[model samples]
Target: MPRIVLATHNPHKVEEFQAIVAEVRPDLDVVAYDGPEPVEDGVTFAANALIKARAAAAHTGLPALADDSGIAVDVLGGSPGVFSAYWAGHKKDSAANLELLLDQLSDVADPHRTAQFVSVIALVRSDGTEETIEGRWPGRLAVQPAGPGGFGYDPIFVPDGQPADAERTVGEWSAAEKNASSHRSRAFVALAPLLESL
Candidate 1:
């Protein structure tokens, strides 16, 4: 099996990608990166994903995959996009990030509480072959947080236009359920074909 490094120290991300890839391409192996962290200074998802992937490829001398994802609120004008993790002032506190976002949208009525989760995945090979793909999950923010399964703003985001049973906040979904509809899953689905080709 070909080994690929996922440029992230977050075990959650590693697990998620591992499952995603296994389901998509059992022949490929995705492992967590132990390389030095690269500065994700890029202002866009694709740029940040590339930055990390490039760094991982350079360090491990293997094909690497990286992802940058965040929630972009429609009323907020796509704010907290790239800065989502730091929205509550740099500790990357998931609770605080969710609280801050909810507070900001407190006055924005349901009609305007639109939001979406966006994920960009990048693959960089040792030879510098690079490819990037993106995915999005459209939804609306709840007035208050709910559920307990997911991390980082998942408790308040509900998919729009979903059936009542399917409208649960991301935090309410099981790992398999979330994987079925998550932006990360969507992005990885797109990358499966690309990985096979590589």
Candidate 2:
């Protein structure tokens, strides 16, 4: 298998990315980076993804992949986009971030509760070549939290234009189901052809 370093220490992300790769490129292996965390000073998702990917490639001397993903709420003007992880503060607490966001949108009506998960995946080769691709899963926020499957704001986000039979929040979906339909999966799908060319 071809091993590619992923620029994150989060075990959940490591697992998710591995699962994503397994479906798209079973011959490829995804490994977590153990290098120092680079400052994600980028203003956009693609820039941030490249920032981390570059750091991982430089540190590990191998091809690296990174994604900058977040929940972009319409009423919030796509806020908590790049800052999703640290929305509440610098501690990166998901619960706190969710609560803070909910409080901010307490008055937001159902129509304006729209949001989408944005993922920008970037690949950085050791030779300095880099590329990025984006994927989005549009939806709206529910009035209350539901489900227990995914992390972040999954419990509160309802996918847009979903069938009545598919009304479950992202957190309610099984791992395999979420992997198949998630923004990250879409992003990986877009990147699959590129990886094959590599």
Candidate 3:
């Protein structure tokens, strides 16, 4: 299999992207990157993803894939869009971030609690060729976190289109189900064809 570097130290992102990419091109191998982390100072997911990918590709001289993802609340004016990981503070504490978000929305009505998970995936080659794609999963925030599956804001996110009687948060969904419909997966759906052409 052809090997490529993935520009992230996060195990969750490595696992998620590996699985999602494998679904499209199992012959490719998504390897971990060991380069220094880039400053994700970009204000948008696509910009950040590109920054990481470009840095990795420049550092390793290998095709690099990167992703920037976050949960954006409709009422928050897309706040925490790029700062989702550090929503509570600069610590990037998932639990604290989740807690702070929950508390901040404590007074928000259920109807106005709408939000979406956004993912932007970037790929850069040794020659500096690049492309980025995005995906969004529309959902609403639950009153409180629930279920034990998934990481980040999954516990508080209930996707739309669920049956009224069988509602479940992203945190409650099976890995297969989540992978099939996740924002990352959707983004990769657009990215996979580009990979094939490369």
Candidate 4:
């Protein structure tokens, strides 16, 4: 099977993307990248994704896929977009980041707590073929964190499409459920056709 490198050192992302890709293109193999991390100086998600994808493609001499994703709170004016990981500090503590976000929106009403998970995936081939795809999962922020699954802001993000009275956060959903309808999944679905050429 042809192999593609996922431009990330994060194990969670590697597992997540592997699962997502397998559903679309079972013939392709996805591998985690072990290259030196590139500076994601880009302000937009697409720019950051391309930066990482380009670095991985150059380093491994293979086609690379990279995704830059974060929760964009509508009320906060989409703040912490690229800075989601380091929202609290430079340490990138998930708990701290989640706490800080919840605290910041404590006073906001439910109707105004709308947010969305945004993902931008970039595909870069060693031969200079490059493409970027995007996906956005609309939702609202819960008053407090719940469930024990998922990573990052999953615990507090109540995705749309659930029954209004019985909404469940991504953290409460199983890995299979998340992989089927997550922002990364949506973006990967968009990127599936491109993988056929490889």
Candidate 5:
């Protein structure tokens, strides 16, 4: 099978991407990148994704896929968009980031707690060609974190389309369910056709 480097050192991302990619391109192998991480100084998700993808492709001489994703609260004017991972500090503490976000929006009413999970996946071929695809999962933030299935803001994010009286956070969903309907999955789906050429 062909191999594609996924530009990330995070194990969670590696496993998640493997599951998502397997569904669309079972023949392709998604490998974790052990190369040096480039400075993601870009202000947007697409820019940061490309930076990583470019670095991975240069290091591995293979097609590289990198994604920059975050939770963007509508009430915050999309703040913490590119800063999602470092919301609390440069440590990239998931719990701290979640706490800080919830505290910031503590006063916001339920109807005003609208938010969206955004993901941008960039693909870089070894030959230097590059492309980006984006996906957004709209939802509202819960008052407190719930469930234990996901990382980062998943526990507090109640995805849309759930029964109003029985809404469930992404953290409450099974891995299979999340893999089928996450921002990453959506972005990867859009990039699937492009992968065929790799």
Candidate 6:
């Protein structure tokens, strides 16, 4: 089986990508990256994702996959688009990031608190060839965080158009449920065939 590098230092991300890939392309093996993390200086999701994937591909001399994702608030005009992880501070503290965002939108009325989780997945090969795909999870922001299922800003995100039976926040959904329709999951679904062909 061909081993592919999932270019992320976050163990959670590595696990998620591996599981997502295994479900569709069992022939491929996903491995954790053990290389230097690239400086994500890009202004857009695709650019940042490519930066990481290219770095991993160069370091590992193999196919590499990387993701750049964030929550874009409608009211903030996507101020935190590529800066989601550092919204609160540079340390990438999840609780601090979530708390900061909540405080920023504390006074905003429910109707104007629309937002979406954006993910850009980049796949790069050793020869420097690459492909980028995007996925969006549209939803409104909650007044406060809830549940404890997901990471990042999941608790404050109320995924749009969820059935009443389903949980409102991504943090409240089961792993299977979130994986079935998450932004990353959708992006990987589109990127899976490309991996299979590789």
Q: Cα-based RMSD of the predictions, in order? A: 1.1, 1.2, 0.8, 0.6, 0.6, 1.3
Per-residue C-alpha lDDT of model 6 across residues 46-111, encoded as one tens digit per residue: 999999999999999989999999999999998689999999889999899889999999999999
The Cα local distance difference test for each model comes to 0.91, 0.91, 0.92, 0.95, 0.95, 0.89
Clashes of each: 0, 0, 0, 0, 0, 0
Off by over 4 Å in 4: none
On residues 1-198, what C-alpha lDDT tens digit does candidate 2 reach at each position? 678999998888889999999999999878889999999999999999999999999999989999999999987889999999999999999999999999999998888899999999999877788999999999998888899888999988898767877687888888898899889999999999878754
lDDT of 6: 0.89
Tens digit of lDDT per residue, candidate 1, span 1-198? 789999999898998888888888988878789989989999999999999999999999999999999999988899889999999998998889989998898888987999999999999977789999999999999999989888888899898767976578888889887888899999999988888765
Q: TM-score of model 3 relative to the true fold?
A: 0.98
Q: TM-scores of the models, in the given order?
A: 0.97, 0.96, 0.98, 0.99, 0.99, 0.96
Return the clash pairs for model 5, or none. none
Q: Candidate 5 regions off by >4 Å?
A: none
Clashing pairs in 6: none
Residues 1-198, candidate 4: write the lDDT tens digits.
999999999999999999999899988999999999999999999999999999999999999999999989999999778889999999989999999999999999999999999999999987988999999999999999999999999999999999978899999999999999999999999989998888
Model 2 residue runs over 4 Å out of place are: none
Q: Which candidate do you rate higher for TM-score, 1 or 3?
A: 3
Cα displacement (Å) at residue 184, model 5: 0.5
Regions more than 4 Å wrong, model 1: none
In model 6, the runs with Cα more than 4 Å from the true position are 164-167
lDDT, model 5, position 130:
93
Any idea what lDDT model 3 has? 0.92
Superposed by TM-score, candidate 2 places the C-alpha of residue 46 at a distance from the truth, in angstroms, of 1.0
